[model samples]
Target chain A: AQTVTQSQPEMSVQEAETVTLSCTYDTSESDYYLFWYKQPPSRQMILVIRQEAYKQQNATENRFSVNFQKAAKSFSLKISDSQLGDAAMYFCALVVGGSRLTFGEGTQLTVNP
Target chain B: SAVISQKPSRDICQRGTSLTIQCQVDSQVTMMFWYRQQPGQSLTLIATANQGSEATYESGFVIDKFPISRPNLTFSTLTVSNMSPEDSSIYLCSVEAGGGETQYFGPGTRLLVL
Candidate 1:
């Protein structure tokens, strides 16, 4: 069974500081996709970033980027220059071409001013 | 990215009743999915609504419990039947866009079964 694990249940950072959220997954399939989704208090989930396992280069979107280490089965998300709006529940997800998203227990992020 | 909208942003329903949530996408899409999110929890894929055929349900979710309908590419509905307190959760619909690897989600329908 493929499983996504987010070790940090809660994370806090200053408004302009950097925060890294760790994520690891167990999957037998070599070709897969990893994602980071942000669910704010509004409960609407937004796509933060995506990583393709075949691509060695990590995925970056604005201040959000992923450190995808396929060999280590690790895909961690780094938020740089974090803003107050970044405070939300961050969920790491995995998909193996079937389109079904397997999500991990989210890490609640708190941005302190 | 697709602009998706769901009807009845939030609702309070009585137990034993059923509520059908509608999801409409701005553009045509081949793949649409239904998911359930418990309070303060992660999303769980309930089923994949296939066009013109029966929906493919995930393990632990049944067709009878979560009957889905995808009549066309831009529209789908998910019905929660015989609702109980345990069924109180946020139901979300998402569509695969771009390369089919990325999915854009709807705002979700919040349901409270009492």
Candidate 2:
């Protein structure tokens, strides 16, 4: 079974600063997908960004980017120019093909203004 | 992106009772999944609801306890039978987007057993 791990239970970053949330996974499959999801107080889970295992280039979406090390099985999310709205519970998820996703325990991110 | 909605956003029920949560997707999808998130915990897969067929439940979940129905591609229902305090959690429904590995989740139905 594939498993995702987010070592940081909680993280804090000052507004306009940068913060990185670490994530690691264990998978035997060579082809898979990794994603970072944010759940705010509204309870709506939104996709932040995604990376395909076969792709060597990291995925970047505006202020969000991932440092995906395929060999290390590490996928970290970096949030730059953070804003107050960036505060939320961030989760790292993994899925091989169209199968079900395995999620990490999640890291509570707090943007200090 | 797909818009997913879950009916009865929240409900408080007595123990031993049952509650059925409905999930509706704006667009038709091939697969629908049910997940449970306990208080301050991560999401756990309950089952995969396939259209016109029975749902495939994961380990620790059974059809008798968490019965699911996927009458069509865009609609599904999950019934928590013989509910107990342990069943008090947020129930969510998700679907794969554009045949991709990424999934979109509903707002979730918060169930409270009293």
lDDT of 2 by residue, A19-100 (tens): 9999999999999999999989877788899899999999999999999999999999999999999999999999987568
Candidate 1 local lDDT, B1-114, one digit each (tens): 899999989999999999999999999998899999998788999999878888999999998999999999999999999999999999999999977388889999999999
Which is the leading candidate under DockQ? Answer: 1
DockQ of each: 0.79, 0.77
Please report how far candidate 1 places residue B60 from its true position, in Å.
1.3
Worst 10 residues of 1 chain B by lDDT: B95-104
TM-score to native of every candidate shown: 0.98, 0.98
RMSD in order of candidates: 0.9, 0.9
Chain A superposition TM-score per model: 0.98, 0.99
Best by lDDT: 2
**What residue pairs are clashing in model 1?**
none
